[model samples]
Target: MQTILIIEDEKDLAELVAFNLEREGFRVMTAHDGLTGLDQASRIKPDLVILDLMLPGLLGTEVCKTMKRNEKTAAIPVLMLTAKGEEIDKVVGFEVGAEDYVVKPFSTRELILRVRALLRRAATPPSPGSVVKVGPLTLDVERHSVAIDGAEVSFTSTEFKLLHILVQRQGRLQSREVLLRDVWGYAFVEDSRTVDTHITRLRGKMGAAGELIRTVRGFGYKIEL
Candidate 1:
């Protein structure tokens, strides 16, 4: 039973989400304000957090930043909820460490699917002895660990999957549509630019090792030493 924390200011909305998730066999917890939600997240350390962008005491971005900065709760995946559909808003959410974003006025079905996808991504480990090395970076697939120049680097589940796919097929061009389908489990190629946003964040996290990931003009990205 995976525990999920819902941080939404609207009581009715939170309850509705909690009810649906519970029906799907998830243990749900709710917090109506940002501060309370953040505190609850730190205390409970749920497997996943469904956080609204706007909150009473703190913004969802801030909560995400704090959670990502904290060692204990940083690995927990966050699915951001936002009323805004602007590409910039979604990018910001991802930049702040959100694993995925959900626009408001969303169907319950879509939201639930995204939640399940994120959990699946988080729980699945790499295959045995499938370690990958590019330049000074080393990815121990079996351990789900990435080290750059002998220093371990932290990546969100989404980022890790994206990197793993790229490195596994180093020098092979991967179209944005393919990456979305394979890494994000998107059935259709919607929001293809999201692949770009995540790539940018992944590169930033990788520091100098980021250069190993190359962009193919008008196509997608790849990794090559």
Candidate 2:
């Protein structure tokens, strides 16, 4: 059974979510504080994490960032769970390496669906063409590594997938909706800013090679050699 770790302070809510997830055939673990959650995540290395933004010991963003920095846990998917619905909050979550965001008062069904989608995406294998190169950027699909100008650069799984798609399609424009559905596995496009925030972060990490990913103004993004 796939393991899912839920880092939430609300005891009742945590139990409720755990129960539902267990019913859906997943092994669930819960932590009430950010520090404990981070520790458990490192030790057990759950397949996915459902993290709350507000916690007693540490902020969720810090936890996510630390996980992304650790080679052992960097590839695990994180789904941010919080009451905040502001655009800035979503951007912050994505910037910290969260693969998906779910606002409070969310439907149990929808949250479960999101969890399944994340798991599916994580389990997906690299395409038949394992290595893709464009200009100064080189991506090893099997190794899940990227290098620019012969120097390695770290990228979260989400960012890697997005960059891989853009590079594979080279000069084609990818609309935000298409990217959301393809990279994120979102059946419906809720917000386009998710795509924009990831693009900004992706560029920053790529340094000079970042320029290869060009914005198409009110449309989407495309990578050009």
Candidate 3:
């Protein structure tokens, strides 16, 4: 069973989410604050995280940043929660490493659908069958291993799919939603932050090889080749 870690400061909301997720046959874990949430995430290494932006002790953005930086937890998908819908805040969430974003007062049905999409995307298998290399980066699709200059680079499953998509697309600009759908396979996931988080983690793992991924302003991301 897939497990989800829900990190929210509101006790009532947290319990409600946990209950719903359990009903859906998912193993659920929850935290009420950012610091505790972060610690639990590292320990459990959940399949996905439902994070609240206004968390106590540490901001959700800070927690996301730390998780994305750590090799062990970086690739875990995060769906950030927030009451504010400011464009800037959403952008910041994306920049800090959130896979998706959810506004407050959201519908429980929508929330459940989004969660299922992310989990499905995370579990989807790659189509690439052989090792594909572009410059110094080598992606062994079948084995799910990545290498830079022949040295192995550790990657989470989501990160691998994200990289494979970029490598296949090469110079074509891919919007965040497009990546989420093609790489993550979630058509209704409105939050592009999911793409940002996975991309950041992918780049960090690739080191110099990551430079192959380029940002397209007012559009999306691509591999320059």
Candidate 4:
């Protein structure tokens, strides 16, 4: 059984999630506060983590950073849950090494699908063809690193994949729905703003290379010369 650590503070919601996950044949571990969550994460080394942004004692972003930085827990995938309009922290979460994001009031079905998908991707071997480059940015899909002008710019897996898709199709616009299906590996069910949040962080990290990624009004993003 693949163990999943759910770091959420809400008692009712946490238990509900645990019940559903256990029913789905997953081994569930719950942590009600951030400090405990971090401690459990290091010791348990779960296959994945469902992290809530608003946690007492440490907050989700910090947890992600701490886990991803530590050798013991660095490979564990994290999916962040955030309230709408907290796009800023969502970006921060991704920057800190989260693999995916789900907005608050999200369907349990969609959340579970995302969790399973992330774990699947984590288990899958990297394809040799996954790497991409555009302008000054080089995305090492295998290593999950982005470098600008030969300088390695740190990026989480999701950010690297998102940019890879954009750079692979430079000079063409992609709708938010398409990006979700492509980089996120999910269909049209997710909130489109998830793309925007990731784009903001991806651009911020890319710096001048970010100029290559342009937003189309009322549509989505594109990588252009």
What does candidate 4's lDDT look like per residue over 64-90, in tens digits?
999988989988999987674476666
Instruction: List the RMSD of every prediction in angstroms.
Output: 2.4, 2.1, 4.7, 2.2
TM-score of 2: 0.88
Comparing candidate 1 with candidate 3, which one achieves the higher TM-score?
A: 1
The local lDDT score (0 to 100) that residue 115 gets in candidate 4 is: 85
True-structure lDDT of candidate 4? 0.84
Tens-digit lDDT track for model 2 on 90-183? 8889878899999999989989988998999999988875878898999998888999989999887888899999988999999999998889
Compared with the true structure, all predictions reach lDDT values of 0.89, 0.92, 0.83, 0.84
lDDT of 1 by residue, 9-123 (tens): 9999999999999999999999988899999999999999999999999999999999999998998999998798798898789878898888888899989988988888778
Using all chains and alpha carbons, the TM-scores for the candidates as numbered come to 0.86, 0.88, 0.67, 0.88
The residue-level lDDT of candidate 2 at 106 comes to 90
lDDT of 4 at 106: 80
Error of 3 at 123 (Å): 2.2
Scored against the true structure, residue 171 in model 2 reaches a CA lDDT of 98
Q: Give a tens-digit lDDT track for model 3, residues 38-153.
A: 99999999999999999889999999999999989987989988897887787677667676778998988878888887777767656849988899988888988888999998
> Alpha-carbon error at 170 in model 1, in Å?
1.0
